[model samples]
Target: MTSATLHGYLEQSARRSPGTCAAVEASSGRQITYGEIDRLSSRVGDHLRRIGVRPADRVGICLPKSIASLAVLFGILKVGAAYVPVDSLAPPARNAFIFNDCGVRAIFVEASRAENLRYELARLAAEPRLLPLDWSDASSPLATYLARVEPEGGLTVEDESARPGPDSLAYVLYTSGSTGQPKGVMLTHRNGSSYVDWCSEILAPDESDRFSSHAPFHFDLSILDIFVPLKHGATVFLIGEELGKNPTRMASVIAERRLTIWYSTPSVLTLLVEHGSLDARDDHALRFILFAGEVFPVKHLRRLKAVVPRARYLNLYGPTETNVCTYYEIPQTIAEDRSAPFPIGRACSHVKARVIDANGRDVPRGQEGQLAISGAPVMLGYWNMPERTSAAFHVNSSGRWYRTGDVVIEDGDGVYTFRGRRDRMVKRRGYRIELGEIETALYRHPAISEVAAIARSEEAGVSIKVFYASRDGHALSLIDLKRFCAHNLPAYMAPDWFSHQQLLPKTSTDKIDYQHLMRME
Candidate 1:
């Protein structure tokens, strides 16, 4: 009777609307209905089970966005196995580390990326079975491979009684670790289903809604884009890699396809507003514009709002360890207030968040302290790192809490606003400076298109350096930036060195590559 797992919702929706379209490829004009998804995923699931994929086993998926990829994702879950999404665009060494760390039973990859996988797999001690799914250039089709593993008509439903419980692992998302390697965050069926259930209640997507899947599967934000739509029998319109990189084209696709739900990082939305010609689109049916991953610059957000005119904006905040613990509805009243960053808002219906001081005690309203969260959305903990997991969580009178490294301020109204990372706070010139505050101020400037702030050690002491991308091809000199900073920021906060780059480097997840930027200067 209970539908607390992600696959449970998928099966429920499929039974409710079998003929409804579940996914569409924008570039190819191809669409797959829920009935088709149920069948194909069943087929894939049979294939996986025949190849020794059992309940609680770990599988890795490193394919691009497509109907095949979605089928594999559900198929892994259908067999009660947890999947690890490997970033196809990441370096081979990084992928190898994830493979060795998780000890995945098998990897579902595309033939196009076979060479890359082979290179990474060579370095690993444990050899996982490679199930390549690309048959574009092959003489045969995927059915040929399926027949090898599964017997005729073996795609029938598995034993429903064997379905994983809420506590069973559903997926493992790897995030950039402080030690430079990636750490896998283990999430159970209950953890992911809790987030999906919360989203279903708040931002419900009916069959009429066409959700845009902009973020890659490797990114946690893509969870809402993928699962939320599938649960409601809505269509998921995949934005290709080329279009995701070009915001202007992405806007055109949104208008052309009449995508109803838009979810992506604030940086991607900012790019769309500045260069995506969103205002020129005539048929942009976007009703909900959900942004997260990083803070949105107010200036860029205002411009985007003008273009959509009627869309509702929601700021979603959470780390990979906790998926969307807090959300803030952007009220029109705050459009005029630009002095402080937007609030991360209150916790979701199923999440509990509190601001705690350094001593692990709760802080009074309006005081800056570390943000902590507990509840259904929290992860099971870091994979295979008990010491690190123990250090990350703290038990108090209320409940066990996962300590978020982020520092936030909670107003008397219970709204939480992000300050900066606790580690990012540095002392320079006998004054404490937050690098994020500097980056936020620099974003307000007209000339700087994108910026990243870092603290560098110098002979005199520590100095601030900013690597910025210019909007006008380096028209603004370092003196011009210095003068602007002098007017807007404190003496210690202003960067002593300004490095100009054509574009800010980005990680595979599309976040600013601050680590790489720090090495530039």
Candidate 2:
């Protein structure tokens, strides 16, 4: 592996193995080798420069998971431009919000979404040039024009070359915020490349290993699923979003593609278990399962382990700001920890983690505190929003560190376990409690499968509103669940209102969509 510099990393890999596989589309099965990626991305850079796109300008990508997406990304960065990844899978409003907020100057979108792009561009206060991408090999009418549009009026080639700096913006990833607005996290070139380097060091996946590119492009988790394989010169089989909606279909794609690596939110795994389908396990092709985003339901983990117990199960923890700050390889003991919500293992070697009390001082061991991370993986800040950025990426009086809103505790062994969220701490019956703490207790019941704890205030008392997903039509009454919680957790943390649903609402990245759920009657 080379240095963490973005261009240096991509350039070195291109030099080392130009013929190795770089990217492949899950839907069309189109593949691009490192050599093709280099050439096309170079051409794309040249094309962008020709069109007056300069360094630091935002370049929006609205394409699907395809070779072109990878090429365009490398190309945009090659031209010293920051890329804003807008998920084609995302809602049009969300996509439009990202583009407008970031002040994108150029866009690359799939032909299927070309109309939407046109409408959005028309509606924009200022219209940026929209480039329509065709996945097919054949040239479109635009290609002829694109060929003729070389650095037009630029006058010289060397002047238009891509100029990239490690500290410069690499991407702007949008995440749903508590206020219903999408917060755009601006990650530097180093932030992304450093993560790739760290992951490549931690899990040395090689070319022979074919991985799944099922995670959506918008999510940071897609880095491992998409780029890590490319960085290692490995093949990545694409699994379409259509198939991903049906876990069985997704599992079938995994088995069919003979995927060896997977990184997804635990909710997808829960869906697999609830459907009683382990498509990949039957074939035994999957050897690695790297779950991130949210806590994994232990029941599903046990079920999955029974099928592929030998598979390396890693619980990865991080925010959109930090690609991945910590990871814990499944210990030999697969038994559920009934004590806390779930242990997120230890902080990654690249990160400095501290569990601090409200006073911003380290708490005694085993005491609950907020988890703050200081590392290269921590994002530069929110794009152009200094106040919110300052709030998130702050240095304590002692040193420089970013405070992660998550609460956690450190064990004697130095391994940290997730406690809950700081905001989740709520006042109930004159008692302050963590809703996540109560939800963790609820899921421990054998009959309960997946559960979410929401704070609801009513005349009866301040109690929790739990939405759960159970297996095989199993049900747990509100009273029974409240009793179960009372036996395990404190009275203040117990839920009085409970709703059992087959599936919980999820975000675009597939984590439990709490805001959407809050809207549910």
Candidate 3:
């Protein structure tokens, strides 16, 4: 049977291979099979229905990455309610904003974090029913909570009238807004399933494949990590927050568990290559390594290729508004001294990409312009912000297209290389400067582990400031660093200030926190 909704993937997998492992916890060595996932999630859905969570209602999930969380997610979908996942590590106020913004009727959270979240929601005059996954009492555990809900007969029926359709809202992902608060990007079942179908076709993993779920559930990267495996009856290993930050532990998990397909940001992969000690371990089981969210420095990618030569490397590109619209597969061999970052590649099979100038006209190949995406994977719109949503897209005779807000150049070969963000370009002393270009050049240096270039407004003009972390904890001489930058970059593009730290602050998704860097003295 063809599954119309995202949860239907799990139902299909369970029916085909009920005993096959669906998910495994790296820290606890716990595993859950497809049959169990189906049954458990059905119970969750039944409970939601009992609690008056009707179709199209929003349900909040504020727990850590675990089998239970995955079950809760599917259960919410099973009952035709959209799930709103907040970063468990984020402050209660931020989570409260998301809950209130989406108007979630109930929240499933861990006991330890529930009180603060409840308090914050109350202060906002928003009261969502709180269901703790684990109780504080000595006798109650997660199982105890599940025991309270009676399981339905089985997975929800395939009748279109009884469940959500492909166009129904599946989840609401909150991303950093230009304003102080975060805004929700609403994605429907069709939006998710289209990307999942494309990936399943491209990767073609069988039941034996093991996928690494490294990204947090709230992040868009987790969409592929969690669903692609489920669609093909493969196992997904959940990497916890603490373990995700530890390079050594991450390396061990990959090699020990034999994770077949690994997906994460280049920053995390860079850490693994620099400190994971990959050369010493036998990681022959890995078949595909995928990265997205940020550009992968060519130099660092070269090092990773040397260690895991057998695996196919792919660079997936997109924002939360368009989930993985384009991808570039690294060639078998790159020049040993390649310094330029690789292109984000062509659009995905299900998506169409266009480069348009400021005047809304299509730019010629080799000309820089803003990238626009229109396809199955394109999001429905921003939640409840019609004006913002209207401004985000450009409607014409062809169709409505979401403006990616990313600048790129299309080559003769039909590949799109990321230039920089539209807003990241700064005019300094009559010359336009791209901060990402400076950061790209600095990444070529062997001593620099991670770097970010910021544009600052000073009395004289807009000056560029560079913040970097060295491979070794010790700081490098400013003279030498400046000399290196001078040799690689034009005089007008050189930075005015440099700051060195043992490590740059990272956001919950593991990307460098530029906002935090800007706030630092």
Candidate 4:
């Protein structure tokens, strides 16, 4: 039978092709078939139920990306529970905050990481059951844990009444909040399935297709990487944390596995192109190179297209609240002199988008305004934070629309070009300026690899500070950078100060850590 929930996708695929390879460990070349994953997840679901986890309960997943983690994710959904994945690399104190905030019933974690998490949770007086994913230590042996928890003969029949529907909660993704705490964004099965359906219609993956899982489990991008491939009985190569950081190893895996579709942030794709030695590798199987999370420099994109001219490049744009609302397919040929960033194309077929002014009125074409999205892909709301959730959307006669907080100008043809974040625009010397615009101009310089522009307020006035990393660890002359900025940007928009680093700091999800830079003295 066809199913609407995320885990049901795996079930359907398993029934259709039981023996087909479902997932592969990129590091070890170990593979798991669809039937195997389905059965393992069922046993996991039985264990969760036996341990008193009820439908609609919240469960935490704190293990790194691996085949076992994927099974646990499906298992949570199988029992009609939403999984909350925390960054395994993050400190236990931070992970404890999320567990306490969400009030998770239980957490699936590796034994090595569980000690720290257990201590932090105890310190917070939050006692959630911790189920170890692996039993490496002598104290927690796999044999003993399995004998106690493993189901007899493995559960094959699912409790249909306990299965979640389209509107049931699927997962909660926590994002950095303005109040210096992480806020949980609640998403339903419908929220995930709608986007997955839209992508399946567009990409049309068959059972033979091989997709790359590059994004971390906690990131929103993983929604597409894990679910889309499973829905079509395709293979997903799980890129572990170590393998994800090494560009050469990643490139080799892509070539060896013959990955057809790749989805990740622009930063990762840029790293592969620059340092992965793709020019000498055989990666002709790549059909689609989809990127989001941050702007892609046109110069760098042009170079990537030159390297893999056969694949289609798409720029997907959206925030964590909405999975992906708008997308633009890059033209095969980009003029070498083109410097401006590409437009975030019109809204997806599953969603409706509007450019609204500050007063919540629709802005005319060619005017700058906030982009609002309303439709299937939009999230339910922030978990238990009704006041903040209400403020995040604009309600009207038509429907509730999510205010993206991104400032964009819609062209006459309806394509939207990102100007900057509403919070990133500042007034200096009586002139309004977009710090992202300044960063975009600086990226045109061949010497710059990564860049971030931040505005600071001082007793005297607002000052713009630019931080950048030069290509190949080469030192960039401040005078040369200032001269280039003056030529490309307006005098008022020019950065007042410039600083260089061998490499810019990145967040856990691999995006440039602008907040960290802002905190720098």
Name the best candidate (by lDDT): 3
lDDT of 4: 0.88
Native-referenced Cα lDDT, model 2: 0.76
Q: How close is candidate 4 to the true structure, as a TM-score?
A: 0.96
Instruction: Write candidate 2's Cα lDDT for 231-340 as tens digits.
Output: 77788776666767787777666667777888788888777766736734567677788898888767677777777666788899988888798888886556555334
lDDT of 4 by residue, 195-278 (tens): 888888778898888999999889999998999999999999999888998988988888888999998888888888888977
- Candidate 1 residue runs with Cα over 4 Å from true position: 138-162, 333-339
**TM-score, structure 2 vs. true:** 0.91
Residue-level lDDT of model 1, residues 37-146, one tens digit each, is: 88888788887777778889999988777777788888899889998998877776788789779989998877777777777778776588888876575433354556
Flag clash pairs in model 3.
none
Locate the minimum summed-lDDT window of 10 residues in model 4: 135-144
Error of 2 at 3 (Å): 3.4
Model 1 TM-score?
0.95
Candidate 3, superposed: residue stretches over 4 Å from native: 135-141, 149-162
Q: By lDDT, highest first, what's the ranking?
A: 3, 4, 1, 2
Note the clash tally of each candidate.
Answer: 0, 2, 0, 0
